[model samples]
Target: MSSVLAKVDWKSQGFRYFPLKLHYQRLFATRVQKISLDGGFTCPNVDGTVAIGGCTFCDNRAFSPSRRVRRDAIQAQIERGITGLRRRYKLEKFIAYFQPATNTYGPLDKLKTLWDTALEDPRIVGLVVGTRPDCVPDEVLDLLDEYAQKTYVSLELGIQTIHDASLHWMNRGHDHAVSMEAMQRVTDRGFEVSLHVMLGLPGETSEMMLQTADQVAKWNPAGVKLHNLYAVERTPLADQVRAGEVRLMELAEYIQILADFIERLPEQIVIERISGDAPPKNLVAPEWCLHKGSIIRSLTDELVRRDSYQGKNCRMQGLPREPS
Candidate 1:
């Protein structure tokens, strides 16, 4: 562990790492939930501009509830999401998250209209757009800047792994260099960037996964969402799992590796998510992922066992501390 952990009251907070909820409280002074919205966008990979099939492990419908339900007007979706989220959580302020597909892979006019419609609701305090690294051109970035100037805007880039061979195995279309270029470009624009990384790819070792984390720490993204590479029904990865060609990480193994991964990240990076799961009907393997609560609890326990917190082993020096 590093000296940084000495100043954090992680034990009292019930999480050894910096969680997104805490980050939100610091920024908004209240709990802010994310309302998932489908902007009716398709990926370059799915549309044949980049490649034929989407990422082998992806079935957007399985990952996003917005995609599973009927598509509605952007404003209507905001209303519906707000109503549902309000029913469950006490949060009033929400961030409009364009989550299902490549949100930036659209005409600028259409993108602006959708984003504008989402912000029309006063309760919506921020915007999150998820997309591939290759999809955001300079014009799209400029458009995002237009929004960032008005309100909080986070661009979630799907840099699943830093290993090019793993990307090739997943048919990710673009290589690691493309991700680095995208990161540099987004950072240049001064937009808050959150990276999405998958830990349990088909051939990656634990060391390889930690290497990805170490590299990401150097980039120093505003946030990171980590999840295991689980298989979903109707995807190529599912077929491989059924054929015994691929194996998924067990819960205990994933927790340990995730703890190690977080230790290598800068403490300032918000841990947006520690695990991900598909809807039970769409999930094909790794039944353990369905229990998100258990995954989080076990991971927290593992971190407690080590008496460590985020950045405990971080090599990056002189990074800004989390805002006071």
Candidate 2:
């Protein structure tokens, strides 16, 4: 560890890792929340532009709350999300997250209309767009750049794993090279980028997962969201789990793996999400995933036991350090 890393106190921060909430507070000087919005977008993989049948593990409704309910206009969805979020959190500012599906997989004009409508609301402080790595073309990035000049903008790319075989097994439609190219373009435009990484994918070993973390550390993205692969209803993964073709990670094993993975990442990256879960009705396996609180608690305990914090092992692993 460097001198700075040694002098810091992790426990005082209430988390073993740098969390997204803290990152937002430092940037906006206020509490911020993300409101999920269904932009009525679909993926090229699903529409047969690139391939058929979306990712094996994907069922938009299971991952995005906005997709489960009745479809509404973009503005209406924002209003409804705000109303619901207000009841849960005492925050005023929010980011319009075009979540659900490939948010940037449409015509430039249509994309502009939806995004502009959300920003029209003063309460929406930023925009977080989720899409596949191959979906964001240069023109789409240019449009996002226009927004970045006006307000906060984050382009979330689903780089599930860097392994080509795992991607093929999941039918991700694109290779790891595509993901790398997308990250380069987005970061080159000075956009804040968040990478989504999935763990516990079938056939990935602990060494392979750590390798993905190492690559992510090298990318030095602004944020990262980590989650174990869990099966949900109406998805191919569920059927695989039923047929014993796939096995989900147990809670304890995942905690250890996740902690190890985080330690390999640089401390500057905001840990956007520690785990993912779905509605009870949609969730199919690893019943423990539904209990998010327990998962978090266990992760914290494991980190404490190891006397570790985020990036504690970075230097030992010869990972690149963030520029001072």
The clash count for each model shown is 0, 0
Best by TM-score: 1
Expressed as tens digits, the lDDT of each residue in 219-277 for candidate 2 is 88878999999999999999999999999999888998899999998887778998885
Q: Give lDDT per model, in order.
A: 0.84, 0.83
Error of 2 at 186 (Å): 1.5
**What is the TM-score of each predicted model, taking all chains together?**
0.91, 0.90
Clashes (candidate 2): 0
lDDT string for model 1 (1-324, tens) is 011233334436777888888777766779999999988777778767788777998874433312322235787888999899989988889999999888888788888888888888899989999999999899999989878777888899999999999999999999999999988788745457899999999889999999999999998888999999899888989999999999899998999899999999988788999878588998898999999899889988888899988889999845764332
Clash-forming residue pairs, model 2: none
